[model samples]
Target: MAFTQIEDYGVIGNLETCPLIGNDGSIDWCCFPHIESSSVFAGILDDDGGGHFAIQPSGEFESAQEYVTRTNVLRTTFETDSGTMTLTDFMPVVDGVELGHTTSAIYRKVTCTEGTIELDATFEPRFDYDRVGTTVEQTSEGVIARGNGEQLYLWSPADFESSEGEEEHAEATETLRADETMWFVLQYNDREPIDAADCAALLRETIDYWQDWTHQCLDASGCPFEGPYHDDVIRSGLVLRLLMNPQTHAIAAAPTTSLPEEVGGVRNWDYRYAWIRDVSYTIQALNELGHEREARNGFDWCLTMCHKDDPGEIGHPLYGLHYPPEMVEEELDHFSGYRHSKPVRIGNAAGDQQQLDTYGELITAIYTATDYGEEIFAGEWEVIEEVIDHVSGVWTNKDKGIWEVRSEPKHVVHSKALCWAALDRGIKIAEDNDFDAPIDRWKGERDTIRETVLEEGFDEELGCFTQTFEGETVDAAALRLGSVGLLPFDDDRMQSTIDAVMDHLMTDEGLVMRYEGDDGLPGEEGAFVLCSYWLVECLALSGRVEEAHDVFESATEHLSPIGLFAEEIDPETGEHRGNFPQAFSHIGLINAVLYLNQAEPGETLDPIGRGATEITTDSKS
Candidate 1:
């Protein structure tokens, strides 16, 4: 079988890991045990060697996928000439139950709603990204696949037959009539057989769990849940929720990695780990949606992972869910890449890069949480002080900016502005709570950084801020200066910067590219989806509500039919690129919608935290 289109897949997860199920009823990508663990089924990456599990109608059929209302339970309907069948897929989640107490199982319930339909089920488990050999065994209860010291048990009523060749797999066939149903449960390292009754109960509980969780957005006293883009906001919220690890509170950038930013390019990198910048963005969005508990948990997790005893030692940009400091990049040469995008990678080497923007983003996240009435622990405050002091000492240094370019570090204006934001927020926290050390020094550094950015970062000839100090190139990240409070939204320089980005970095389709400059990598990448949303936010906050709405609608029109977004989009083809269901993209969508909904027709809005809080207050009133 050929590779499925990246947008043709729907995601379902149990907070530990996620599986991408194509509309054709094939689970093409899944990482078991943990989101960062080796793949159990990775046919999406390599159509030939990477294994997959599929259940579909025997003959040609039309299929469509959708989520059960306000829930993550996915329902894919197949319509054939003879009958119609519905496949309900979900990883069962129960309230109040610890993740360790339950078996991490994927439940697929198939129901024949009309006439009769014959279905084919194929189970191929490729442990360890298809590098380790796996053996399939038939059992009385179901089937088992063992490899790389890991075992997967497939429980079903249909009698599955195991193949005897080198590329081993199991196959089964079932025919169901009207009102008939069948169940398939794949568990990790567990042999407990689950019947149809168990599946039915679990399905109901899972639906309730998601629906109840979603309802919190609407039920929260001060959130602006009722808006023109309510459905889009809710779906984006759900996607962001799926990327969060409930056990570890670490929010992954995406589940599957190395999906490529371009079809056959080398821009692929593993995003299964949590980055401080990404997590901070996710927390701010969750806070805006009134999901304070999740926001607090994510913030706390980031602090716990990045905390250091030495004041001078700064944390890495990203870390593993288990809090590993370094993620050594490795390539899997055995399997073919997605669409032959070779050199499929496992870990992210960029984790160790000096991304100075993290200090500002993390401090801004802390300030936002406190604005929502979340108290900062004493130790966390100390860490914040150390971080601010470190930023004060290093704001003049050169480093990789927000995009994590692999080129030599430069004095990125955005990074410097973020460092200024870090100091500004740190001083606010210290003053707001009467917990202080050296406010005068922080203020001095903050003012100096601002003046420096305004002077050296701005290009007089371009009439806007450039990507680097004294550079002449425009970057989409410059659009964030106003939103981060580095400048007022209506400031002449800020407005000119926004126009510079739109004219230089935006595609014909209105999607924004990160930059047109080289990033020390080969091959071109697609227009970044998150950067496009940043444009939407900038436009909205600057009182250009109609323009913002137009850009937002144009960008969201490219969202998958099921409302999921990848990290980037091919502007020419409107196809998704990069990792599937990116948290950054979804977080951008939520914040953009909130900003658009709150912006007045002729007045500039405040920066993110303050502006978002005003909407909550107005909604409550």
Candidate 2:
């Protein structure tokens, strides 16, 4: 029913929750209270039953949207025959001080900048995914929406009237001249009513808070290629931060669920839950960009969830919002899928699979944070050792692998390489800190893994590293071997794999496919953006600097106009597919840009526009 293009949206959040604001000026998707909570405004799914909040020009108009410079606050402008107006949307965020604000709120301000303009707004809420009953009432403060034992207060500075009989909907229209401003606040639950007088100040404080935080990000001074890709790097960091749950420190893969990898396909699954592997990658990226606070938070989350009595058993790959894993995959039959991609799933079944690569990811994140000057307590080190021991115990087993294919497990090459990484980092941390551990055992196991993988994962005839042990299908994951420190850039095997990947897995658009073989899923998905970045890294490392730059430019040319990217891209149409504003995609962009910035001895292209020579191995060895 709701047919909104996934790309036609920008996001604003308070680190606790986020709302997807569409180009047409509608809050189409949001989860109230918590990122994983039930949706209050899900018009992105069901147009009629699902709720929405909209502020727009009354007549036919053209609109544009963008996030404010260096901040997550979204500004949407509408131009109509009458005039033009801009709408600013953000959630109040205050740091370094307590503001006695426990309730969540969305603040919206509208300002006219041209001739007289007529603007209309609506407050429509469908609770519990439109399954629960709700009652709306007009009050002196503003309007009240009550449902599921919770209340939402709507306050406005201007004089507006609520509908009498149909209390569920609130509509208002006003004519405004240039420079005129109107304010509205929608506060969740009942605590203290927000005063209309403070609306302007609240918006200002929120803006300042975001700007201040963005400025703190490690930028041009210390970072090599900060100038050319400054905006992309900063925004990517912000998006990653937005995906982080502040209270629990868990980072979501993506906010929305069931946005298919292919239109009308069944690859839809919820990514709101935090995966250990994803969080590790996110932390590594954040730490590299001088956002150490988020990295520390991610490490602490892993400790709390994966340490102590249970310690998550090493092989478990994900954690729910709270403590235990809640990744029971189920379809939400109530709402139509995005673009009719049916069987919309709420939970990810991949959480239970034996993705052995997570141990490597977790250890790498912890070690990376240490490089950022974060201290690991003795208790945390013990947990790290436990994970390494587990990896050593099961390094030779079959796994569902990083792609989380829904078929019989196999000895994925990437999984084995990551197991080597886990042992490698564990040994490094132990040796560097002089902590107690079986160093010799870890060293032996690490070497054993390297030898096995080098022998079995590579195919001399194919001249590339295969997806699985002794297999011939080229996988994009092989491109990561050099980046992850498992192989040298100039190593013959690594170079051959790089050339083979470009030859087999690349689309004409320069995007890279995840693998050549099917993994038991129906329908075709687009080229993975992360895999494309991996190819760029491989190319840069292999002394193919100019080729890498061409590939990098080609891949980035397909980014959404505002620089956002999805999980996958339709190689044919160049359209974004899957969950939008994807964390991994942004991570890939930041890393590739950083790699190109430090690329060595290559043609000196414009510093901001081209490649860097200093390749960071992430201490994978």
Candidate whose lDDT is highest: 1
Query: 429-529, model 2: which lDDT tens digit per residue?
Result: 78778889999998899889988988898898999889998468899998766666777677678778988998998899888899987889998899999
Candidate 1 residue lDDT tens string, 145-179: 99999999999998899996789999999999998
Cα TM-score of candidate 2: 0.92
Q: Where does candidate 1 stray beyond 4 Å? A: 97-100, 216-223, 310-315, 610-621
Q: How many clashes would you count in candidate 1?
A: 0
Off by over 4 Å in 2: 97-103, 157-168, 215-222, 305-308, 602-621
Best by TM-score: 1
Evaluate residue 367 in candidate 2 and report its C-alpha lDDT on the 0 to 100 scale: 71
Colliding pairs, model 1: none
| Clash-forming residue pairs, model 2 | 596-611, 596-612, 597-612, 598-612, 598-613, 598-614, 599-612, 599-613, 600-613
In model 1, the Cα lDDT at residue 221 comes to 58
